[model samples]
Target: MSNLFVKDIVVSYSGLPIIDRLNISIPDHKITTIIGPNGCGKSTLLKTIARILKTDRGAVFLDGKAIQQLSTKKVAKRMAILPQSSEVPPGLTIFELVSYGRFPHQRGLGTLKLEDLKQIDWAIQVTGLSELKDRPVVALSGGQRQRVWIAMALAQDTDILILDEPTTYLDLAHQLDILLLLEKLNKEEERTIIMVLHDLNLASRFSHNMIAMKEGSIVAEGPPSKVMTSSTIQKVFDIDANLTICPFSTNPILHSYQLSGCTQDLLENANEG
Candidate 1:
């Protein structure tokens, strides 16, 4: 089990800060979700943790060791990240795409090892893509293509998995399927899963811990019950909404109101009256 800690980190682009002195800790072998409005630096934070984006200030520590000090190959062996979008080769087969995940583990000029084969098989099985293993990546549906990308990440066999908007284009069923797969990986395989999610309800249901950000800073973080409050949502999103507890789970459910013409006029009249 390895813990990821971000200490007072700040990320900037073109001399403008996007992540401002943020501190966060992701527990080992748990599923953590980051939620916020667009451009709130959720993806930026995840990228920094994965070492894709270099931090201008502070440090990211994995298992108490500074991540910057580690070599790229070493970091790749310990952590795998699936960015929001991936570049697909025009004629690459699923197996070829998934095999790229083994690059970090392989030695120079060595053949594919048994462990690699096993890992690739496991990734394919877990992502439910065994049937499409030989198919061309360009031929798969959007959901299937997403699953293939996930399979590639899984084939990396790293302890920490960072995903940015893994369910972006998927429909409801596929989104749930991916969430359940990540949950299983965390619980059964003892892997740490960190992801960025826009859907508040899905984040509350799937994540063991949640971090909510606003305007390049962390606003609230903890279990869904503690962080997903009406006040927090309103403050972060600038929207009036009702919060209720789900019947089965104690997570807060946000019901947003879309003010109509009549309702807006009535509210104004009430204030004037």
Candidate 2:
């Protein structure tokens, strides 16, 4: 399978390393989720690979070509990225926002052509935003706004989609809504997806591959069955967890979890002191 390869990448902020010599191969046409605790460089790695952030060393390779060497428009034609927090303009309508995705293909003044309109409409329909095409993005609910951003990405018509914490700031139902939409896109359009996810259970359920990281280093990467073990979770997250296999789906499920030591024991020790 084709892969997006990161070779010896190093990223630093203020002379302190965030990601050090990180090497990973993200398989094409599959949903790959990166899971880790906060400040673990998951978002930084995604940004570097998407060329939104400059790498201090090494490079990201897309299909054997260095991503940095490619023109911005060239890269945009092949991949689209939706970052964690995107600031929208004051009053851009959903249709207008989605239409902006066609900029890379436009020759003059960034005006939408006939094909652009078709693509924007398709993106809106697929994301269930057809009725709200004229709605101001700032006025929409969180989930609706998220879908609008996703529709904009879809309108880019790229084979690879990279999202940083796509489900952030949403209720459980809305989170599932976005994830299910991504699964459908992957299955039907064969879009290769890479994302940073905070929820382990949801990541395991939807990801074809999972990369677990800690302290800017990858601890484990493989199918969820191989990487989502009790030991691996403890090692990567430093949290005690029970890993159970679901009888029906056979997927690894995180049972009950807590701090490694008992609360009662801590209280007893405190009283003794």
Candidate 3:
């Protein structure tokens, strides 16, 4: 198992810091979720940790070696990152797209070795994409397309997987589908998973560790029981919410949110009049 560490990392945009001296440690073989409101630097931190964005200061280390010092192909062989959005090539089949993951492992002439072929097949099967292997990338539903991307990541055969909002733009059912698939990969295969998630409830239920951030700094970090308090929610998201234990997972769940200055008060006053 490989562990990732971020130490005092700073990422800036246009000379302003988006991720300001952020420090975090992702546990090996566990699911860690970064949660924060929009523009709070959750996704920026994830991308920086994955080495997609250059840090203005400090470093990210994978298994004690600075990530920037490693070769790109070397890092690709150990960790895979699925960004929030990607462009699909026209006329690319699902299998063809997934097979591209073997690029880092290919020798001269770029033939798929036997082990690589087996890994590709296993990735498709695990992601439930066998039936759609021959389908064109542009022809699939949103959920299926997301699975195709995950299959490609799985085909990379890396120990660590980093995703930015994997369930974004999906309906409730598709969101659950993607979360369940990631859960299975974490539990069954013991893969180290890190992602930025928008839904606090889903993050609480599925994550072994949750890091809550506000303005590029972490407000809390721990299991749901420790991190999902009402005070923390209010601090991190600027919303008043009630926290309760979930029945099935026994994790902290957000029971309700009270939006400040909502029109309900006006409606009540009008009714009284």
Candidate 4:
């Protein structure tokens, strides 16, 4: 188990800061979800942890070692990342796409070794894509395609997995399926799973730790019950909402309402009256 520590990370694009002096630690062997509004730097932070994006200041440490000092292959062997979207190579089958995960382990000629085959098989099995291995990637539905991408990332066989909005473009069932798969991977396989998720309720349900960010800063980080409160939601998302115990699960559930433009003025006038 290796902890991911982002110490005062700062990320910028085109001279504009996106993640500003953010610090967070992702515990090993747990599922951590980052939830925020669009463009809140969730994806940016994930990419920095994965070493896909260079940090402008500070450092990302994996197991107490600076990630930037590690070789690309070594980093790939320790951390696997599934970006929000990936280009689908023309005419590639699911099996072929998943086999690409072996790139980090290849020596010469990029041939798949016995170990690679075993890993690919296990990844496909875990993702339930064994039947679709031969199917062309472009021909599958959005959910099926997303599963294939996840299978590829799993084939990397890393201790840490970072997924950027994996549930995007997935239907309700597929979203649950992916979340459950991640939970199983974390609980049974002892893998650290970190993902950027938009659905707050799903994040609360599936994650062992929740990180709520706003404007490149973390608003709250803790277990869902403590971090998903009405005050935190309002502060992070600027929504007036009611928090209630979920009927079936006993978890905190947020119910928000649309605030009419005149409602505030009317309420203020009534207060004065």
Using lDDT, give the best candidate's number: 2
Off by over 4 Å in 3: 260-273
* lDDT digits (tens) for residues 1-273 of candidate 4: 346889998999889999999999998889999998888888898899889889999999987888999888998998899998887987999999999998898888998889999999999999999988998999988888889989999999898999999999989999999988998889899999999999887888888899999999999999889988877887887765567666645667665433324547766997999
Query: Which stretch of 10 consecutive residues in model 4 shows the poorest summed lDDT?
Result: 254-263
Tens-place lDDT digits, model 3, residues 1-273 = 346899999899889899888888898999999999999999889988889899989999997888999998999999998999787988999999999888888878789989999999999999999988999999998889989999999999999999999999899999999999999999998999999999999999999999999999999998989999988988888777878888878999998887634646855987999
Give candidate 4 regions above 4 Å deviation.
Answer: 246-250, 257-273
True-structure RMSD for candidate 1: 3.1
| Candidate 2 lDDT tens digits, 1-273 | 365899999998788899999999998889999999999999999999899888889999987988999899989989999999888897999999999888788886887889999999999999999999998999999999999999999999999999999999999999999999999999999999999999998898898999999989999999999889988988888877878876645779787676665745865887999
Give TM-scores for every candidate, taking all chains together and pairing residue i with residue i: 0.92, 0.94, 0.94, 0.92
Q: Residue 100: error of model 3 in Å?
A: 1.0
RMSD (Cα, Å) for all candidates, in order, is 3.1, 3.0, 2.3, 3.3
lDDT of 1 by residue, 88-177 (tens): 887999988888888899999756899998998889898989988999999998888888888988889899999999999889998988
In model 1, the clashing pairs are none
Lowest-sum lDDT 10-residue window in model 2: 258-267
Residue 218, model 4: Cα distance from true site in angstroms: 1.0
